[model samples]
Each structure stands twice: as C-alpha cells, then as structure tokens.
Target: MPRIVLATHNPHKVEEFQAIVAEVRPDLDVVAYDGPEPVEDGVTFAANALIKARAAAAHTGLPALADDSGIAVDVLGGSPGVFSAYWAGHKKDSAANLELLLDQLSDVADPHRTAQFVSVIALVRSDGTEETIEGRWPGRLAVQPAGPGGFGYDPIFVPDGQPADAERTVGEWSAAEKNASSHRSRAFVALAPLLESL
Candidate 1:
C-alpha cells in the first residue's frame, strides 16, 4: 500500500481522514504527520492546505495531504473564514469560538442566519505534483448550541433544506452520520479519484 501523510497534528482530523480514505481507497494508507508545523499564513483555504501539504512532503519525502476548513456565516459576510480557529482570540477554544459566533449572529433573524462549512483538501507529492479540491455544506446556525458529538461550532450548525430527522446539529450526529454528510467527507470524496490516478 502507498503511504500518505496527512499534515495535521489533530488526532481527530487524522482519524476522520483515515476512515474517509479507507472507505474510498483501501489500497492507500493515510497517516498523521509528525513533522514540524508549517505556518498556515495563507488567507485562503486552498493556500493553507497547500502550505501544510508542501511542508509535510518536504519533511517526510512522501505524498502528503492537508486540509483547511471553517464555517463561513452568510450574514457575517464570510467572516471567520480562514480565521475561524482564531475567532475567539487565538487559543483555538472551540466553545468560545462557537459562543462568539452565536453572539455575533444573535440579532440576525432566521432568514439571515445562513452559513456553510467549507473544506479544501490539498495533495502534494514528493516530486511536487500538487492538486487541490474543495467542498461545502450549506446550513443555518441554531439560536443556541446543542448536542455533544462534534467539535468546533458543530453544536449550532444545522443543515438547511434537510428533512426534519436530518436537521440535527453536526454535534448531534454520530461519527458515521457526520462522515456521510460532512464537508471533509465531501472534499475527500472528490480527492479519491485523484489519489487513485496518482
């Protein structure tokens, strides 16, 4: 099996990608990166994903995959996009990030509480072959947080236009359920074909 490094120290991300890839391409192996962290200074998802992937490829001398994802609120004008993790002032506190976002949208009525989760995945090979793909999950923010399964703003985001049973906040979904509809899953689905080709 070909080994690929996922440029992230977050075990959650590693697990998620591992499952995603296994389901998509059992022949490929995705492992967590132990390389030095690269500065994700890029202002866009694709740029940040590339930055990390490039760094991982350079360090491990293997094909690497990286992802940058965040929630972009429609009323907020796509704010907290790239800065989502730091929205509550740099500790990357998931609770605080969710609280801050909810507070900001407190006055924005349901009609305007639109939001979406966006994920960009990048693959960089040792030879510098690079490819990037993106995915999005459209939804609306709840007035208050709910559920307990997911991390980082998942408790308040509900998919729009979903059936009542399917409208649960991301935090309410099981790992398999979330994987079925998550932006990360969507992005990885797109990358499966690309990985096979590589």
Candidate 2:
C-alpha cells in the first residue's frame, strides 16, 4: 500500500484524516507527519493548505495532504478566516479562542450572527504537483458555547438546517454524524478519488 503523509502536527487532525481516508480508499495508508511545520503565511485557505502540503511532500518525498480550516463570521466580515486558530492569541488555545469569539459577538443579535466553517484541503505529490478543494459548513453562531464533542469553535457553531432530532452544534453530534457531513469530510470525499488514482 502507498503511504501518504497527512501534514498536520495535531494528532486529532491526523486521526480524523486517516479515518476519513480509510473509509473510502482503504488501499492507501495515511501516516502522521514527522517533518517541520511550514509557516502558513498565505492569506487564503487554499494557499495556506498548499504551503503545508508542499512542505510535507518535500520533506517526506511522498504524497502529502494538508488542510486549512476556520470559522468565518458574517458579521465580522470573515476577520478570522485564515486566523481562526489564533483568534484569541498566538498559543492556539481552543478555550481561549472560543471565549474570545463569544465575547466579540456577545452583543450581536441572533439573526446577524451567521457564520460558516471553511476548510481547504490540499494534496501535493513529490514532483510538486498539487490539487486544492474546499468545503463549507454553513451555520449560525450560538450566543455561547455548548457541548464537548468537537474541537476548535465547534461548541459555538450551530450547523445550518439540522433536523430537530440532530444536535444543533457540531460539538453535540456524534463522531459518525459529524464525519458524515462535516466540511472536512465533504472535502475529503471529493479528494478521495484523486488519492486512489495516485
């Protein structure tokens, strides 16, 4: 089986990508990256994702996959688009990031608190060839965080158009449920065939 590098230092991300890939392309093996993390200086999701994937591909001399994702608030005009992880501070503290965002939108009325989780997945090969795909999870922001299922800003995100039976926040959904329709999951679904062909 061909081993592919999932270019992320976050163990959670590595696990998620591996599981997502295994479900569709069992022939491929996903491995954790053990290389230097690239400086994500890009202004857009695709650019940042490519930066990481290219770095991993160069370091590992193999196919590499990387993701750049964030929550874009409608009211903030996507101020935190590529800066989601550092919204609160540079340390990438999840609780601090979530708390900061909540405080920023504390006074905003429910109707104007629309937002979406954006993910850009980049796949790069050793020869420097690459492909980028995007996925969006549209939803409104909650007044406060809830549940404890997901990471990042999941608790404050109320995924749009969820059935009443389903949980409102991504943090409240089961792993299977979130994986079935998450932004990353959708992006990987589109990127899976490309991996299979590789």
Model number with the top lDDT: 1
Screening candidate 1 with a backbone cut-off below 3 angstroms (N, C-alpha, C), the clashing residue pairs are none
Where in model 2 is the C-alpha error above 4 Å?
A: 164-167
Model-by-model lDDT, in order? 0.91, 0.89
Angstrom error at residue 71, model 1: 0.4
Worst 10 residues of 2 by lDDT: 162-171
| Whole-model lDDT, model 2 | 0.89
Estimate, for each residue in 1-198, the C-alpha lDDT of model 1 and write its tens digit.
Answer: 789999999898998888888888988878789989989999999999999999999999999999999999988899889999999998998889989998898888987999999999999977789999999999999999989888888899898767976578888889887888899999999988888765
Per-candidate TM vs. native?
0.97, 0.96
